[model samples]
Target: MKSTLKKLLPFAVVGVMSGATTVGALQYFNHDSNNTDQSYFTKASNVSFAGMNSAAVGDDFVKAAKTTVPAVVTIKNYQSRTSSRASEQDMLDFFFGDPFGGKGQQRQRQQQTPDNMPSGMGSGVIISPDGYIISNNHVVAGANKLEVVLSNKKSYIATLIGTDPNTDISLLKIEEKGLPYLNFANSDNIEVGQWVLAVGNPLGLNSTVTAGIVSAKGRGIGILGSQGKAANPIESFIQTDAAINPGNSGGALVNTNGDLIGINSAIQSTTGYYQGYGFAVPANLARKIVEDIKNFGIVQRGFLGVTSLDLSDDQLVAAYNKQKNTNIKAGSGIYVTGFGESSGAEDAGLKLGDVITKIDNIAITDFADLSMAVGSKRPGDKVQVTYSRNGKDATTTVTLRDQKGGTATRTKADLSVTEKIGAEFQSIDDKTKAYYGVNSGAVAKNVMEGSEMAKAGIVDGYIITEINGKPVNSQKDVENLLNKFSGTVQIKYLDDYGRGYQRGFKMP
Candidate 1:
């Protein structure tokens, strides 16, 4: 039976190579062989042996490439600028040889116009079937014109929908429908050594695919500054050995199943090209950014407003031993330096010098993980934060809020104060005056910031019937009366928005 199976193995290989029914042949060979030791099957024909090995690798590459390439797109941007001290006609005539003759036109005028407008090329991935594309903010930043070229060579003009430079993500809209897109994979589940593909238009060459394994996770390159440009820059990058080059900045870094796990953002190289080290913004971070921009005009970032540093191995060991009188476990974690007075961290009872161990059930190995987790949440969202203080582990829930004391909700009446220099004047009417219970006068509901009334200790919600012993009912009348005393305007009005009392200040 083993000899008969060995004889049929060559036929099975040939069947597979020739696009024949190889499954049946392989099944028959395995069943007939029935022998535990299968070394005899290697003695098949050399052509069959070569075919099997090559077919396996070729099939995998073909399948992965076919699935990912269509979702990759080439992005081109054109910036427009206006020249200083020159009419459009003059610039056009200078470049195209002036048809209308003018004096001193042939003097070989020096073109002072600098090339402020630059063209750039990058890559993008289709995230939605209805033409929503995702790319890097730097790729489409300040672009007056954008063009997207698909794998099929079809090009379409793209409009910038929104961008969040803090997360290095931007959304673009195209007119076409039924476009191919890549589904986002759960980046939290991705682990080191997992196979992944990097698809992009590297060096302006469209639709290039490269394969590699994930090298590391939660990498911080400090590309995003402290304020985290635009908002808080989430810097939890998935490091991979994939060859991501310059034009790949906005491309897709997909997993084995052709699902987008990250957005290829940058490569660490001295020559400005791939050198076996590439970085991608995780897909989870990118998704949150895209959603925030689509909903809000700006990314609503929650700020803990605290400075922190990652604990060094030596420091961690020393701290543990000093507290517990034992050796420390080897693990990465962050130490809190201090908390800001007006910060959410302070309000949430987080004190100085606490070692943060985890956030939202995810391990906070370093500042990168903490930043990524915090950046992914919106203002007003609550998160569970775990930390250690004096060798004791503890957890707490903190509600995140914006840095500006939450959203500003103010009305015309709220602005009535000497500190606020804006005024609101109402039209002259009995019902309006009666609404405020004022006698024979309309309420002043508005004030200009630098107006004479503002300088005279008067603000919004001030009621005015007479100015400088002259009757005044409208804003124009006040302006006319104030025009008389440019040097030192004296204002007389009731503080309607504030306490109902007359007050005056000398305008300078």
Candidate 2:
């Protein structure tokens, strides 16, 4: 197991806005649009995987595969580089003339991607007959265009609805009705040892299905935050022995009755292939994310604002106890290490070293449990938190807040994208602007910790002269440019010392 841990690879096969008139680069949810459909999630109480006869196992697998195959799709991501201005192109060619010793060879290599070719391919599960689909955010990130191919070879140009990098879930839409779709089952009710089917277009094999039992639940593999892509990675995965590979991401993980229990996401392997361990995002969490995107344009993630250390490992607990001069037991609960700014936990009197035992009656034995319980809620939702402080049990009500530390509902129109990225920007003062030698720019007045910008190494006092290759003259310009597109955003700026820097992060 130690050797396997060393070789274990956590992979998912896969931030903010500012300003007035932000309208956002990514498309916001339109309440007036006809795509709204909340009926995709089935009642949690209705799903049960109990007392199945062993003799009927083959029949159950057949039934599940038959029901879900048609709803799964092959997603082809198409992206073409935006053409640079000819003058800028010429200047580059003139200055750095083909390092390969052939005229324009370097330039050609830079722009070698054919416009008609797909940049990446993965799978998606249709959740609504009106053409709402759910897939992994990594599957469709940075695509200039998305094409969805159904089982029957029917294709449609898909539109990205919204994405939650924290959960690795993305919502997509296509123009068609009366299509086969999957209903979200109560993932909370799924049990280990119960049979589940992994259905997707793995390795470009369309409409493929593999069978396995649920090996574990509430498992955190730390896959989403592997590269700091997700500042607040919410990873409570349903682990299975199913054979999920590169293309299985964003695909369906369903139960014997063909109810969608999870979305097949990451795999634990040494060679980047399935190695008997696979993980999926719980259907309940994915359902909440898509719904939030449908209703609010961005994920309405609620933050408890407390950072803590998981007490699941005995060795770590012993070391921590020795260091802190306390008898902290392993598997007792997560111990609070610190609190974020405007933290509800701190305000509710949760002190450092408090062991969080439960949230609203749900056991908080590990980070996964804590994440799911809190990750499922939105800002302003109150949770009863039970904790042990100095071996004394106490309860408190914690009202969650959005990343911006507000309890108000967040909509694209009301929140600046800049604020979403964990930074607040203002037009640079003329002196600072002249010092940086930029005609137009915004000063990063504040950069929130653990935000996408902060993760990208952006700091306060950075002069943002360009974003997504467009000039940003004012806070409003920053807002407008950010709202103009979705996916990865490139930023060029200058440090407080006037040294130039460039950074990029995925748009939240």
Candidate 3:
């Protein structure tokens, strides 16, 4: 027998266990009919509930689990046999902690099965009475079909509404109405040691409930960054000691009153099984993402447009002070490193050596605090930023902007197919087209990280001559060709070095 153990990274092996499954490339869908009102979930109090401070704080696990179990459903991921093989490679990379891992060895665990059979299983929480469900993006990323199974064993085919890779949340909908759902609790009010329940279908067990306490909050475990944009992964996980296992990915983390406080996401384990640590996405941030996807067809994330160094690291602070000949103290707050293009922080008079202390009166002691504060807002939303410069406190109101530095709120209709695919194109020059021996071509000007194009290995400077067998000479041509495609789309392109290649990705 061969040993299956692989080298684990030093940063605590994190397993995205969706119940012994294979994840695939993500496909996004934006349909007008699937859009719903933003007021689907009932809001809970931001302050403590009526019996939060009572002596019997954790004695009502039975009631809480009973109320929430019906709302938590099992999600099955079904992928066609013909989808790109890249998803298999990605899954291997996710499990083994290697980009090019498991290439030579054939996958022996997953045997060939019918396309109708589910390839993976996880859990989801119903947020609306009309069959709207919320689950982790990894749970249903590469599925050709999705099925939602209720606690009563009733199954319904689900439609993918929208997804936010940055937050690792995806929304699904069924045609049924008058379904049981969970209310959203203000996760910001949750404290350490508070009683909570993890309701999900873990290890193929349906309607399993586990009790635990909030061990920590605002934990950045570097989990979402592996699946999302490395530079902009919004990970302020609610750390809990719940026994969340493989099938609990998108399940509900509820309070004693059955109010949803977070979504169980990842577990810190080396064997891909639940150990002692589990993480959940706070309900406050998840609610914002759900509302954005429901109303705007995409997340309205705001960016402060400046990178910073954590002042908590004494050595890093000392090195920076020595390099710059400045007496910067090591303490709370993040020291500004640089500004992004068209930065709102720069426009608001924030400079590189300034230390950000607060955002909208909320304390910003580290990147987790800063990420949660800004990641929950929309573009054009203004935040009062308090910072320290030369040991003097100053305040400035920053008008937050989008990734492109725009302040306007954009809807799904505002984005072209090329943008949705995660890239922008520019018409190739006549000389360039002649050199490539093509009559018409377009160069990928900008490629968004963690996008379909990026997943398909498309990068900046790649010249695309055809999309879905149609000639693409300009940006408009690319969009027109892609818009007409529904399912897998094939592309004929040349890399930045003029090497020819072909790729395919699914679209809906």
lDDT of each: 0.66, 0.77, 0.78
Estimate candidate 2's RMSD in Å: 13.5
- TM-score of model 1 (CA atoms): 0.61
Q: For candidate 3, list the clashing residue pairs, or say none.
A: none
lDDT tens digits by residue: candidate 1, 185-214: 999999997778899876545787876788
- Alpha carbon deviation, residue 15, candidate 2 (Å): 45
lDDT of 3: 0.78
lDDT value, residue 100 of candidate 1? 56
How many clashes does the backbone of model 1 have? Answer: 7
RMSD of each: 20.0, 13.5, 12.9
TM-score between candidate 2 and the true structure: 0.73
Task: Pick the TM-score winner.
Answer: 3
Q: What local lDDT does model 1 show for residue 292?
A: 68
- Candidate 1, run of 10 with poorest lDDT: 35-44
Cα-based RMSD of candidate 3: 12.9
Q: In every candidate, how many clashes are there?
A: 7, 15, 0
Q: C-alpha displacement of 162 in model 2, angstroms?
A: 0.5
TM-score of each: 0.61, 0.73, 0.74
Pairs that collide in candidate 1 are 423-446, 423-447, 424-445, 424-446, 424-447, 425-445, 425-446
